[model samples]
Target: MWDHCPLMLMRKNFVSFHVNLVFFQVEDAQGREATIQRLADSIAGPFVYSVMTLSAITFGFWYYFGSHIFPDVLLNDIAGSEGDPLLLSLKLAVDVLVVSCPCALGLATPTAILVGTSLGARQGLLIRGGDVLERLASVDHVMLDKTGTLTEGKPAVSAIMSLACEELEILQIAAAVEKTASHPIAHAIISKAESLNLSIPVTRGQLAEPGSGTMAEVNGLLVAVGKLKWVQERFQQKTDLSDLTTLEQSVMHKSLQDSQSSNHSTTVVFVGREGEGVIGAISISDKLREDAECTIRSLQHKGIETILLSGDREEAVATLAKTVGIKDKFVNASLTPQQKSAAISGLQALGHRVAMVGDGINDAPSLALADVGIALQVEGQETAASNAASIVLLGNRLSQVLDALDLARATMAKVHQNLSWAVAYNVVAIPIAAGVLLPNSDFAMTPSLSGIQELSGYGTQKVTSVDLVKLEMTDFDVILGMDWLYSAMPQSTAEIELSSFSSQMSLF
Candidate 1:
């Protein structure tokens, strides 16, 4: 609730922002079409109209024919006054109409949605609505974000290249100077220093320039940490830093090698002290999560195509893709946010239902544009991504993506089952109640049976018109417990083994 306060304020402002605009045409079309769509989508919609029509036909039939047929039955069984034929016919027709409960039809899907969402919440998956589940069941392709989604967002310090100075001294000065910056690389250095239990010294006159670097006076020395270009530019501006050019060249040479390694791409940060020249460079790289590879494989085995979409360099994206077992053709690299959105649109144009998983500001537009948008709710995730997403992955696990797909398909199946049963019940029983077989004495059904059929379809007895009253609150939870959906997923995903059953239940 607290997390959504900003969005609530935005909505409040947005409402007032658009108050002066005339949207008559759009609103009219939306009003008419939305109403029609809502009515169509309601589980009991068709059934209710069918029941009304059947009730009128039943009334007309008995009103014309009851006088002849019911008189014989009542005379044979009763000793008291026989009610007027018209009144008896009207009563039977009303009974038939009233007992055909649309409430059960309405309650069926909503109940499942409520239970499913609540169950998902417990499992750290925040499904926005049942409509998302409905759409997820049709998704044939999944576009994944490389950072944060597949790999742990946190990058750790890998190696330090020091010039003449011990690596420990370089780290201490860098950590101390970087303490004022909140960049990912800064955090990596600080985290590494803390892991080594090194004390970070207090700095004076600290200044940080966005996209440049951070500089401060530490232990009476002018210490700085940042990108190689920014650090070099800073060095050129300082007369005392003239002697640091050779050291800077050495650090750059080593950092280039560390970055060019085929294993994975790494970010490098340069460190310098005014009087001592260049200190060293620190290498930081994000590591893949434990379940990332397995999750990608699991999704692929289900015949759901997996695509890696990232703004990272092609080499880096390719390395992560290879590590995760994603096909080369599906890997998209160095894409701007708009390009990512365009890719999603392209796939959709090809008649593929797409699900995009991302966790950053750049991914927000594509996330919103995808058929089903899934955002990994990691610590410090951008607000835009979360707001655009239809489903929020609170646990930040790729494996949970599989769980969501399985649950969505299962929930949709339940909806179909419920709706089919309701339609079949009305189709078969309505004719019987209308006395369709009354002329054939051999198989003619009695009035008691008419009432019985209606009530039985409702799965209840003692049903009154009140029981058939439109269910004011048809929404019900379709609880999909972790164990239930988990059991339904491939055993390879559950057991972490290769098996022939992996493709049995594809979400597509």
Candidate 2:
């Protein structure tokens, strides 16, 4: 019996602590692996290795050929006793080593990433590191999770079709039963009741079935609020509910046809009691983010393929895809977490680099599997979705994702520019240190040649860092200057309320 009930077994065996400890250890390992993976993917690591290899080759080549190729340059500079061919060769090799400075290569990617992420943060986009930016720049496909990525994730009561009682009365009973439930649908019903200032009856002996519905005793009667099938299963065990089932089919059909008013996808929850039959049905809908369509179109315009994946009903998912301008072939519906991960893997198998965007726990696995995972920020510390993601959007708007993509591309372009300059500097300076340009170059000592190369590397470092800072500072000044120009515009009340509510949730 204890084995069947894990909670009971935990209390009896004292093994729960060990289990939890092991679970945490796995989580820690995953975090460390993700960090290490990002560091390995960064541009600086490869540049360092390349520069070191080239430096070694430069040393060997100059050491062997200094006497033959630069006989004029070396003989003129040799001192009395230490001026042998071998010593002069050694001196040229040392100059070559010092001139091939890796300082510029070391600082190139990291500085650009720092400036880019700081700018991104100011605009509510959180770039995890240079690796994520690098991935973002090359991603050709984007997999968007429907619920919180495209839709608001907040369900609202769209319609109330009451059969056996007044709509208000049915809502009061349903809200009372759902008050103790933590589901999003439950919260929507409760919020509707509160907004109407309805007085709810007391509830007792409440029980909630995850992903299905909730049941509770209200006004001395067992009131259930859930899917039609779950309610029918519970009610049919005690009494016949054929009439209620027929009524539910009618209500559901009606709700589906009324998609114009409800918009997007809507879920119907049956409210009823045993023996008394079905009383009413509540139609709840999740609204699409106001900018979702525009954002999708923008991504499409950039030639990036956009795909929608959701666990929602197929019809609803199709409707959303159509509304957002995504092709029918690219929309996938009714996928489990494992299926979502498989879809990402399949895309990658086809040679497409995928970026997964989501904001829920169900998305965590797919987020981890994608080449780049971007979590839409909800008001919280850190979600499992965010932990698995390489990029996170701190703002609620879908448009912010576009901003992040643009910033990442720009940052990468800057990184390439810095690296090109660094490589070119080494190419030209190493040969000079090897005495190729020594006949025409006005360098009296080996120290002077190395000093010029070191100064050039230091100058490149200062220029790269300073240029980014100036660019970001200039953007800030422009925004501050234009604040008054936009201040007189009226704001949407709905958007204002939603933004404030989102901000408040983030604080906690």
Candidate 3:
């Protein structure tokens, strides 16, 4: 009950300045359609209207001056003015105003974005907004977090090596130390012990070093389980364990190397005790997601550069990159969460548009920093990485990254097409309304014809009605106008609800 207090709420939120900084940054950036529409509404709209209004005044003055100087030139049969300059000028001014249709210019970008985002929702992508789609279309580099983004985040313990203690003894003690951690590697150790019917001892003074390892007191003995160097540094500092020999260190290094060079790409975690020093190594293997390779290949085929960035060791990062066809120069290993964000920032500083893919909470920083952040959902394991991401794949499929990219490019293509149509419509209509051929042939676009032509742009669809709602849904919600329908809800249920609503309306 004490946990429900308001002061306790700040702990979960504002975990760091970076987290809040990323989440609040949505207001500063606008999507492709939004940018275009903003320019149209704020600047282009007024500018074009002013230009048309001034053109009418200028054309009226020119015709009025011509009526006195060369009356024959001002006489146009279209308006039936009988050489009356005021009537002709007023008629032509109205024609120009009607012909300057700004509807298409406003509607072009937004319509495409709405359809694209809605389609993405149907395909298991919960895109934040149309701006994300625009960013996805522009991504040149894709930075991938190895453990969860590329490989199956779930790892299983395959082998264990020991120097001073038995394998089972090291395993049990390691599990006790790891039970405090929520990491996939920790889960692997704890799960392995559970599978072997070994009960984990209740640990005291359990401590975690994020991205490095964990420590705890098991059976009144201090134990450290994490990276080899991390475990060695802590244990070797203790005077009681100072006598740990150089021969044992060399053997551990050899075993660590051997563990890395296995047929399967594996990560090695060291187990160290207070008195015995570096006692053993645990080799854990995480298989790649089934679609990881194909997705990377497709992105590469589309000329997108792919990079592997992770907190894992260089050997582990390299092995995963090689398996996925990412080049060696593109791989960076042993990065903390902050370093991952810094690497992405460096790439972006070099003018490369980088997209980050991650699945763990540690990935939130980089995911928030990238030009586009794509997060893959992990079943039974959810992280706030999605909260920082621009796109979330709820199906947990890596191939959906490519699906997002393709859809973005295609949607942008549609926007360009719509813009082209708007420009072509304006280009042809304006000159005709301005009465360019009135002197000789009396061929001019009348006010009625101009109104009809302008209506042609907006009559097809109420494009502005496409509400670009700020949707932050984990599951799909298809917003069709004012009605909200869950994509997961059955069709019959929706129909029944709609029928019930209609009956209520009839009774009213």
Predicted structure with the largest TM-score when compared to the true one: 3
Candidate 2: tens digits of C-alpha lDDT, residues 1-508? 4657545333443234433432343223223222323443464567556655655665565556645665565555632254566655566656766777666766566656655665665454556666677788889999998877888878877777777779888889999999977555778899999999999899899997644568999888898988666665666543346666565566567766756654456767888786765678887788888888999999999999999988665767898899889999999986777888999999899998899999877788998999989988653335678778877765556777787788778777777787778777877877676656655663433856687667657565545543543332223224334333123223422234345545644543
Candidate 2 regions exceeding 4 Å error are 1-71, 74-91, 163-165, 180-184, 199-265, 272-279, 335-342, 348-351, 361-369, 378-388, 439-445, 465-508
Per-residue lDDT, model 3, residue 23, is 32
lDDT of 2 at 202: 90
Backbone clash pairs for candidate 2 read none
Top lDDT model = 3
**Candidate 3 lDDT by residue in tens digits, 8-47:** 4344432244323323332222243445556655654684
By summed lDDT, which 10 consecutive residues of candidate 2 come out lowest? 27-36
Sort the candidates on TM-score, descending order: 3, 2, 1
For residue 503, give model 2's deviation from the true position in Å. 39
TM-score of every candidate? 0.63, 0.69, 0.77
Deviation in angstroms for 402 in model 3?
Answer: 1.0
Residue-pair clash count for candidate 2: 0
Candidate 3 pairs with clashing backbones: 31-131
lDDT of every predicted structure (CA atoms): 0.65, 0.69, 0.71
lDDT of 3 at 325: 95
